[model samples]
Target: MTHLFDPLTLRGVTFRNRIGVAPMCQYSAAEDARPTEWHLAHLLQRSLGGAGLVCVEATGVLPEGRITPTCLGLWNDAQESSHARLAQAIARGGAVPGIQLAHAGRKASRRPTWQRGPAEPGWEIVGPSAAAFGDYATPHALTPEEIEALPKAFADSARRAVRAGYGFVELHGAHGYLLHQFLSPLSNMRNDAWGGDFAGRSRLVLDTSDAIRAVIPDQMPLFVRLSHTDWVAGGWDTEETVALSRLLKAKGVDLISVTSGGLDHRQKIDLVPLYQVPGAEAVRQGAEIPVAAVGLITTPEEAQAVVAEGRADMVLLARAVLRNPYWPAQAAIALGRPEALVPPQYDRGWNDWGKLPVELAVAEPMPAL
Candidate 1:
């Protein structure tokens, strides 16, 4: 059984442990989608904090695909070089660097979440149809020509990502983004060939993944984040997701990162610990490939149980790591072991736990650090 601290190898990349940092958008990029100094520092800190793998945020393939003014981009050479610098910094901290290429569709061009606004901005959000993302924005419908151009954008970004030294690439196909918008019937109301059937609705994601794989090297691992269920009636469901996962596996994807319930603004989800674990298990069993589970997984014992019982191949942490960048280091102690994933700077303090129980160390002084 694979434990939380076990190593995992995919393609030519080997992770030191199964714990990975989820790609959470920093919203600290330049207006033109270039990576700033803040982006480099944030990722480097997490890597140093002891994650086996660090995935950067959802980066846009085009200017209009950005979620906010400060999202990263890989559509140009300058952006590619900037990302390469970020990758170098992450490597220096002893973690494998990864990137998530994304297109927000109707969810694009919004003010950062820190601004706390309710209305959509003036930018034109484009999607498969002229539908809004639950009153978020009015998207412009794409013609056949425009729809064909979107895959080229994805391929161009993938080529740049290889040049940027990313060890892995994840296609952002979940959370009601551009590809998810096409997948969910509730959001995609197009009656053309791009809609009205499972296979037709899935065309964009399949074609986009194919185009991306064409540009990236076979040695680099490729994955996709999928919304297993839309959590709404008459919307995309688990059956469709299972079918899609098998198809994606045939398209040469290595794993599926299972996430759920972002297809609508009025989504009523049951956010419980390991609520998404079953989805990951479903994909793992149905697709017969590795799957990463995320969502309210805060404890080491719980994460260990999930992996040990064959529920998931790995665990992804976003907000948990934000609350404690050293969560992995603490997790080792929680499981009654301490190893060298900790930086040498913290080695002296490792002995300071004198006579305290491991549970006390995990409960009392972890998040405060």
Candidate 2:
């Protein structure tokens, strides 16, 4: 049986432990969509704090696909270079560097949460259908040709991620993003080949995965984040998600990061601890694929249980890690594996008697050469 601190090997990559830091948007990039110093600091710290896999946030494959003007992107050379630096930093800090490629669809072009209001006139948003998400402007429905071209766009982004030295790539098909829009019948109301049936609706996601898999090395792991449920009546739910997971697994996807909701405004979610683990379990059992569970998984014990009890293969921490970058280290100590992932630079921080320093480490001035 696997535990939280046990290593997980997917394809040719091995995570040092099962504790991964979920991608959280910083929304601090410049207009050019390059990662800023904030990203380096934020992601590197998580790696140094002992996360097994430090995933970059939902990065736009196209500029217009960004959730906000400040979202990070990899659609250009400069952005690729910036992400390369981040990938190196995560590796040097002792963790696998992964990235999530996304297209926000109708949810694009919104202001960051800190600056919420009407967005300045921006590029027209595109989706499977012309639907407005809540108060957002109606997006233009993508033409069939545009639909055909999307997989290439996603493939191109995966190429950039390989160029940037990412160990794995995750296709963001969840949280009402472009791919999720195609997956959910509620958002993709169309009568064409790209809609109206399960095969039609799932075509984009499968094609994108195939395209990405073709470009990346065979050994590189590919993950997909899917909203297991839309949480509204007549919306995409666990059954379809399971079917999609099976298809993706056949197409070379190694893992499914199961999350839920955000496809519809009328979503009714009961916010409780481990509320989403069942969905992950359902997908894992139905599809026979390794899965990662996320959603209010705060404590080390809870995370360990999810993996140890075979509820899920891994647990991703978001808010808990944000509050304390050293969450994994603390967890290691709590689980009686204090030496599991302590960085040598901070060896003094942990002792055999469960004593831990309040701070990770203090840098002393270098002696004069």
Candidate No. with top TM-score: 2
lDDT of 1 by residue, 1-369 (tens): 778888889989898788889999988888668889898878878887777889999999998888876778889888999999888788777789999999998888887788844325447789988878766767899888888888899989988988888889999999999999999989878788778789889999999999988889988889899999988878888888889999999998988899998888777789889998999999999889889999899999998898899999899999999998888878887887565666656655655767323321111111111
lDDT of 1: 0.85
Model 2 alpha-carbon drift over 4 Å, by segment = 348-369
Per-candidate TM equals: 0.93, 0.95
In angstroms, what RMSD does candidate 1 have relative to the true structure? 4.6
Candidate 2, 1-369: lDDT as tens digits: 888888999999999889899989999997799998899889988988888899999999999999988999988899999899889888877789999999999999988888885458677899899888888889999999999999999899999999999999999999999999999999999889889988999999999999999999989999999999999999999999999999999999999999999999999999999999999999999999999999999998999999999999999999999999989988887787753466656666555446664334333232232
lDDT of 1 at 58: 97
Instruction: Identify the runs in model 1 with alpha carbons over 4 angstroms from their true place.
Output: 118-122, 355-369
Residue-pair clashes per prediction, in order, are 0, 0
Q: In model 1, how large is the Cα lDDT of residue 122? A: 42
